[model samples]
Target: MNEEKMLKVEKIRRGTVIDHIPVGRAFKVLKILRISTDPGVTVSVAIHVKSKKMGLKDVVKIEDRILDSSELNKIALIAEGGTITIVEDYSVIKKFVVKLPDIITGILKCSNARCVSNMESAIKPSFTLLSKNPLSIKCHYCEREMETDEIMDSIL
Candidate 1:
């Protein structure tokens, strides 16, 4: 493919670029980022695209916005190998893979429906990271272990 043909999306002068998202998961990333609420920000999403290293991958570009560390942590749950690139003046100022936090709270709801976190109280869901390879978390209240896939539906 020609260089121009290989480039599916235009470069951003400034903002954050999330790369190497698994194929068909770009929208999930957007949902986790709450992109729909930010109508003013310029965002680009490319899905089901070929990647040299990741095979088929998805990418998300947000113009003039840098995600907070907590936001990045939420992304790590779904996009394990995803890289975050901070762009400035059309150059990458920083780049790193999303890292999972030691403890995750309020970002996702507990899988157990009867868990205290799901009740009509002020209690918020909390989880402790148990593993990263296959991605697992244990609910702090219910002590229920959840795999990565199960966590998707429980996302708040």
Candidate 2:
């Protein structure tokens, strides 16, 4: 055996890989994952890699964590059309598609201040995607049109 052959490569024993995330949201995913708050959980991230849908993107590797549907929904929002691969012993066991929710409610904060959600806490916020045609949605609480770009940059 040579010195090079002596090198060991670490691999995931079991975990989820959230890939194709938009360039800046990798850390946001981490925050949402709350890995730092939990022990026995591991996470790794890579940002601004070459991608087809996203010219640049980030990836998060989570270990020993099973994300629930609601958290998955939040991931879908920030990843903005990504893929999730669940790996066991370095082999892919499951694959999931990330899609923008048809109805996004209370997940995203309306940027339009005049938008009612911004004004009233009593009213839960909601938005319905008007079209996958151009990635646009209508704020249900405010009756304002919000595009994906706007949603991405919103205060939410």
Candidate 3:
């Protein structure tokens, strides 16, 4: 049997499909998206799936929901290089890879407890993108650097 024939996942008529998620990260995607908490939303997840481009990857299909910019930003913090496809009437209307912004604000909490963003009530947490491939970021207020793991933990 062909690879396509062996794979069995249902299509969503309207919603967003997140593809190329790194292996074992689909649950994190679900956590960040709060998909399980919502009873009305239908979600399908495939983990450790064979991927020609990524070797092993995960795919998340969210039925009847489209992600917003903030959600995309959160996904980028963890699932960088993953692609988001918006489907309408079972057709892809838009597709794009997740890209981290130069400056990320209010989406992630600074790891440093002493950071001004954390201590001060008026300030919101912010970070500056330092690297992409390895995923490094620097806190705007504390100058503390965070890598992918820390970034993943700090998602708000």
Q: What is the lDDT of candidate 2?
A: 0.73
Best by TM-score: 3
Candidates' C-alpha lDDT: 0.86, 0.73, 0.89
User: How does model 1 fare in lDDT?
Assistant: 0.86
Model 2, which residues run further than 4 Å from truth? 1-10, 52-55, 111-123, 131-136, 147-156
Tens digit of per-residue lDDT, candidate 2, span 1-156: 321132113346788878877788888788766777888887777677666566787878888776777678778766757788778877878888888788987667887888768887898778887876456778887678877567766524
Q: Looking at candidate 2, what is the lDDT of residue 132?
A: 63
Sort every candidate by TM-score, greatest first.
3, 1, 2
Q: Runs in model 1 with CA error above 4 Å?
A: 2-9, 120-124
Ranking under lDDT, best-scoring first?
A: 3, 1, 2
